[model samples]
Target: MAYSLVAEIWSELAFGMLVFALRFFTRWKYSGFRGMSYDDLFAVFAVTFWILETVSLYTCSAYGNNINLSVESALAVPDSEVPRLILGSKLAYCAWIFYILGIWTLKGVLLCLYNRLTMGLQQQRFVWVMMVVSVLTFLASLLWHILSCYPTYRAWQIKPYPGESCTQRKWNYVIICVLDVVTDIGMMAIPIPMLLRASLTVRRKVSLVLLFGSGIFVMICAVLRAYYSLVLIDDNTVALGWAAREFLVAAIVVNAPSIKPIFSDFKKRLTENYASGSWKSGTGSNAMSSGLPPYNGKNDIENNTAITSGNHKRTQAYKMSSIGRSQPKSESQDHINTATDADNDSTNSNIGKDGIIVTTEFKVSRR
Candidate 1:
């Protein structure tokens, strides 16, 4: 059982680190470390605490081998084994502290994202309010962890069989679970109004909503973690496993918006390669023989009257406007819309007549 728990912890650590690395790489590719936003800094801190938590969990489960040890059961352990159990209990406490730190730091990241997305909009005020609430709740959660068991040393008491509050810390789980869910819901709320008001097709709007609304999965994980933590009070391994899963989900949710650049890069390369292949196959010559423009890079841009690239692209059919701004213009209007792409790079617009379509990106400037 201990070996299995160790394997699970290692797996979580590997995947969590991978997600963080990809997130940072994409961000750095577009904006160097100096260009990183508050959310990116928050992610750094979150990942740091997560690494600490992972180390603590691994040590407690693998070296201590102290799963399913109730307070009463712990009192009967051999003298030599007692020290191991005590150490495990202390490590478990440290792991929860690290977990709390990582979780709240992620909340800060989400709030930073919301603040940036809602800049120059009425929703900005709501974000400020949520920020205040999040700070207070985080303090409350941290204080609960520090003061819940009382005289903290009892948390590691094995001989006297300290109360369940000290051994299991049930109230801490409940408090953190409730507060975490509330903050996640608040984060999800920030993007909805902007998405609804934007002049986007239903399909695009739904996709954006689903992307931002991924927090629902994290909330579900929180609830299950709390449920099993209380239900299986003797098995710290189960609770730790659930907490790791919850953190993994939250990390993905926090980074999903920023990782769009890598995908956009892949799509651009694929389109360029496909067009290049067509020209090399003499398809261009055949099209010219039939008095039709061949499918080549130059013709592709000329036909659409738009330049597409990994960093920036211009589209005639769709125009993504800034938040807190007017809807996209009609085909008759000569208005130009400059969209901030996944790489945070802007492009010059070209004149074209097409139906209105809108998308969104996070920009720091207010207009």
Candidate 2:
């Protein structure tokens, strides 16, 4: 009993955190943008699922009475008495309605994303068909859930003289399980073709799709829940525990909504770097040159003339100016230009290596 209560509390807390985190991440991702789209649908699903799971937690008496009932006692309670044993069992049924709604909304969003990703019209149409089929399957699940028990309240409540006998059908559960598996596979497969077309390295594209596809882990949890469902057929003790576990796992699975912002930030940084031109090959040299202004031509001539007249300070100044001009644009370039220019400038201050220094002459061309 203690273990069960602990598990229940942990599950509820985990589910609540996942919902909050998904909302936070979605808002963070789209904080700079306006309006809504399919991504926000996932956020809605997360919140909806959180609410439903909270209802289930309450209805299951996860926090309240009968908390000390042994596993055997829990199992012994008949379905008729289970509602009284629990707190919000009736409300839980209503919650499942919303859970089903969230599932349908999620499927629609996944299909829309697939459609946006697929390039060809034919592929897009195929995605639409699959989406429609998934929706119909989900609707069928909803119908089964609603009618699973004739007098649905009998699912939780017990009366002195039960009017109509309403029992759970194994086939109904099986149908829901089948629908889950099919849609899980369909959603997982939808991104493959588009991931293949992404303008990235093969490794990068594969990594991205696999990362996005990690939500398929939820399907694995669903499969496990289906297995537990078989055990739950006649055993409320086992069923309640397994259901709680599955709810927790589902909460974790829906957390894909939170990852969007991380991916968005990465893309944003890449865009900024690309736009700054800092990624160009020769830009580094210009960046370094801009930090230090070059010496003027007049100063170069005066120093060179003083150097040729054997003044050591003037010679040093002339050498420095020559060094600045001959310093190649990059570390890869040779310093031979510096040595030759310095030697010639020292020998004849009147003529520089590149051109003759004409201090008093100007040429004007008219064309």
Q: What shift in Å separates residue 162 of candidate 1 from its native position after superposition?
A: 0.9
- List lDDT for all candidates, in order: 0.69, 0.50
Clashing pairs in 1: none
Reference-based lDDT, residue 144, model 2: 85
lDDT of 1: 0.69
Instruction: Estimate candidate 2's RMSD in Å.
Output: 19.7
lDDT of 2 by residue, 283-310 (tens): 1110011112234422122222222222
In candidate 1, residue 300 scores what lDDT?
Answer: 15
Instruction: Name the candidate that leads on lDDT.
Output: 1
Candidate 1 lDDT over residue span 1-367, tens digit each: 3347777767887898898898888767655565477888899999999999998887777656334556567667888887777788788889988998999999888788777666656778999998998898888888898898889888887777777778767888899999889987887788776676555567967877798788899999999999998898677778888888898988988787777657766776687676633221111100001111222321111212233333465544221112122221111111111222421121113312231223323223211
Q: Count the backbone clashes (under 3 Å) in each candidate.
A: 0, 0
Model 2 compared with the native: what TM-score? 0.57
Candidate 2 — what's its lDDT? 0.50
Q: Runs in model 2 with CA error above 4 Å?
A: 5-33, 62-89, 119-121, 160-169, 197-199, 232-237, 244-367
